[model samples]
Every structure is written in C-alpha cells, then in structure tokens.
Target chain A: MTVTDNPRSYHYSDNFLDFTDEPARSRITKFEPGNAAREQTILRKLGINGWGRWQYFRTCFSDQWGESKQRPLSPRSQDRFFEALEKLRIPKDSKASVFLTDEGNLELVWLDDADEQVQIEFGPKDFEVYIEGSGIDDQYSYDRLDEIIDRFFAG
Target chain B: MSVSGTEDIARAICSDKWDAETGILSASLFKGAETSVSRLSITPLEDTWTVFRKNVEKPPERLLDRIGIINVQSLMDIGSNFEANPTRLSVEPDPLDGYPSHAIIPQKISRGLANKILKSLDIREEVK
Candidate 1:
C-alpha cells in the first residue's frame, strides 16, 4: 500500500525517535567504528566506498541490516538512519534536508523556500517521487537542486 | 534597385550574405521568408543566422506573450504530457563517483562561501 494508505502499519520505533530527535549527532555516532561497523562491512560487501558512504550506509541499513529480524534490527531501520541524517548540522548554505516518512521512504528536500522548492523521494522499494513547487519540470527541479548545491558549495 | 533586386537584397540580408543597414531585417519579412525555406536549411537558418533575433532581443516580453497566448489550460496539458512521457536526455557517469563529495555542493570552499553568505544574511538561524 501507499504511504498515506497504510500509515498505521508503519509506527515509529524508539530507534527512529531517538535518531530523529538529534539526527546529526546520532548519524555521526552511528557512523563511528563501533555501532556502524556492520554497516561498514556491508558497504564493503556492496563494493561501495568514499562518496558512496552515506548512500551505501542507507542501502545496507535498509535492505540487509533492517530486514534481518534475527539481528538487533527491523525491516525499516533505514528510516532511523535517515532521521539521524536529517539532524546532522550540514553547512548553513546547504539547502538539503532529509526526512523519513512512516512508509519508509527517504525524502531529500532541496532548494526549499519562497521562490521554489524541490523534493526528491527514494526508498528501498525503488519508489521515486519528485515534487516541484514552482510548477517547473522535474528536470528543472533536479537541475535546480544541482545548481543550488553547486553554486553554494562551489562558491 | 528593381523590386526583384530589393527582394534579392532582402533575401541576401535574410540569408546573412550582406549585413543590413539596421543590422537585421523586419520580423514580418523574416517570418514569412523563414517558412518558405527548405526544412534541411531551417537548422542553419535558425541557429547560425539571427532568424529569431527580434524574439531573442526581448526574451522576457516574448516569454510573457507566449504565456498569454498559450493560456494555462494548454500549459497544463503540456506539463501533464511531459510528466507522463518524460524523455531520457543523457547517459553520462557522475564525475565525483569515488570522492567523498557532497552531490549538492561542488567542493569544501564553495560550501564555506555559502556558509559565509548564510551567516551574513542570518539565514543560518532558520536552518539551525
């Protein structure tokens, strides 16, 4: 079912709550040697490294680690991972915000403000959702995200 | 010059053979002649030559006119069709695939610059 259709089935767990409360700090702690070592091992297994760190972390945390009920994880633990990411103190000029929906979708909101706002949604189920506030094309939305981030960070 | 010679001069200026006295010809003449040219020649006519020079000169005005003439209903149709049948434009691999890069920001220095701007404008508080 869609996110809106079955919201109750996706109740927020303690892990999700804890991570969301202080995402930046929580993500940093999770990325450390001890807690996310399994995540690192999984990243290695997936042949991901460097810039792929966070993405790989998300994938592993979702598909493998989250799904393994026998372990100390659930099938939607990536929601917690993303919640943690949202709290992280990115550069103030960094207009990117990550959010985890009840339905386990990870949303990346960028270029959000009065003039224009763009949202890129992805999840373990390959759900891709994009919304643009200014009625611009999705390509424009994607390009705007790239432009804002590039212009800000590239300085 | 004869009317045909004047027309030929118009065609030459239109074909960009000789620069016109006013730098470009009138829009009415340009548009009418432009439609008569062969389809294969249209690309060079449109790109290399200033076929839409007048339109380009006042792009904002032209854009506003386009919006006005097309109306919101047609625009909605176009947008819906585009959303339903999006085209794949490129297939290039990402350049910073292996680096510890932020996809949104270009590099650390740009990030710093953005931070400075944000701090100056007090936008950092909103983000925090």
Candidate 2:
C-alpha cells in the first residue's frame, strides 16, 4: 500500500461516538478549529474515559491554542498521550488539569490527598513524574507507566 | 515601572491553558522552555498587557484572551523553593515592544514549582 494509504497513518476511527446527543456547546468559543462534527470526532479520538477533560485537551491540537504560536501537538506526542491514558487509573472523582508543553508533549496534573500537585509529563518516548512539595521526581519509560500508576493510586 | 512583591500580576492565558473541568490554570502556562530569555512574561494589573496595544475597536477580543492573576508575593514564595545558584527569585520589569507593563519572573522554574505557582493563582477570570 502507498505510504499515505497506510491505515496506521490515520489518527482516529471515523465512527466512535454521537456527540450530537450531548448538551449544546459551552461558553468557550475562541478555540474552535472546525465544525461540530469535527470537534466531536476530536473528542472521540481522545477516548471517552476522561470525557470531562477531553474538550480542553482537544483544543491543544489547534494552532491558536497558545498566544505566541506554540507548536501544534505533534503526532508522536499524541500517540504517546493516548496510549498512556489507557493505562492510567485516574481517580473517578478527582479532577486533573491537562496541558501541552512547549515541546508539544502532554502533561497531566492532579492534586494529591495532601493538596499538593502531582504532575505526569509525557514525552514521545518517556514520561516524567513530579510530586509538588515532595522529593518524588523521576522519569520512566512507557513500559513502566502501569507500574507507576498502580503505585501512586495504591490504597 | 518597578515590580513589587506586594502587587498582583496578570498573565494572559490562551483558552487552552485554562481548564474548564478544574476551573484553574495549567502549570504548562508558566514554562520557560520556549522563552530564550529564561523568563516567563507577566504584567502588573495596574497597567495590564493591553496597555501595549494601540487603537482597536475591540481591544481585548482581538487578543488570545484570559487573564490569570497571581500575587507577586505568592510567586516569590514559590520561587524561593526553586532558588538557582543561591540567587533568590524575584519579578523584574522587562518592557518590550512598548509594553512597559511587561515584567518577568527571572528564573528557570521547574514543573513542580510551576504547579505550585499555578495553585497560588488568586484569580482566573475572562478579560472584558
């Protein structure tokens, strides 16, 4: 098959979810890159697990997501972020703030029981974890993502 | 104008930087990796970032626009933890392109400290 015809090149499946059934768009209007269908597709590709934060995450892919023309989210980083999310057991009740670094990587943050922020920045190959006001700072390959998640959420 | 630790500073945030789910700003907004000067841009509330802009029908709307207000003292408190070379962190005026209100936290901050500063943000409101 031609390089462009490769199925792996496509980011997301065409049919994932019916975002039309959800409530009308919220107040955020500055970052719309395309029509409603396109927006829904972007959200679906991001997966439905943490749907609440997906809307915010989807905008990171836009060219205008930053003020000074930050690089658009790279495909490598996108693949890494989506793959990593599948292994994380983010607390159902806890909210996590999402961000795209200057290097076009993904960074997820949430407050721990002590109200200190915990950051997980995912690069193309490896990810780094940093716990605020603590000494827990280190990097791990994608293979160890599951192990890290389990340790952090172990109850 | 000299920046003071007591004054409140406003940093313009793009829509993506403000998480609607958590109703807070992201730590990534404070990263200096892209900045060649090793400083993150901020402006005092008294002057605001818009002061640099010239005539426009709707000034704020044309901007990539949300403001996160954080106290300079709060920034200094967090910066103290990430002291580099034993030099204390402080905000200093760095006017650029006629933006006299422009100022910066003159330090290379870590993501952990950036997150701490993110939590210290006193206000996250849409600019009118």
Expressed as tens digits, the lDDT of each residue in B50-84 for candidate 2 is 45233111223323345567667776777776543
TM-scores (chain A) of the candidates: 0.29, 0.56
Judged by DockQ, which candidate is best? 2
Which regions of candidate 1 are displaced past 4 Å?
A1-96, A112-114, A125-155, B1-128
Best by lDDT: 2
RMSD to the true structure for each prediction, in A, is 24.9, 9.8
- Cα error of candidate 2 at position A5, Å: 27
Tens digits of per-residue lDDT, candidate 1, A1-155, equal 68788745556765564444444224332443333664553343322322243443344333212101211112234443343333322334424433333233444444434423344444333323233443432322332434543533233
TM-scores, all models, native as reference: 0.21, 0.62
Least well predicted 10-residue stretch by lDDT in candidate 2 chain B: B52-61
**Roughly what TM-score does model 1 have, to 2 decimal places?**
0.21
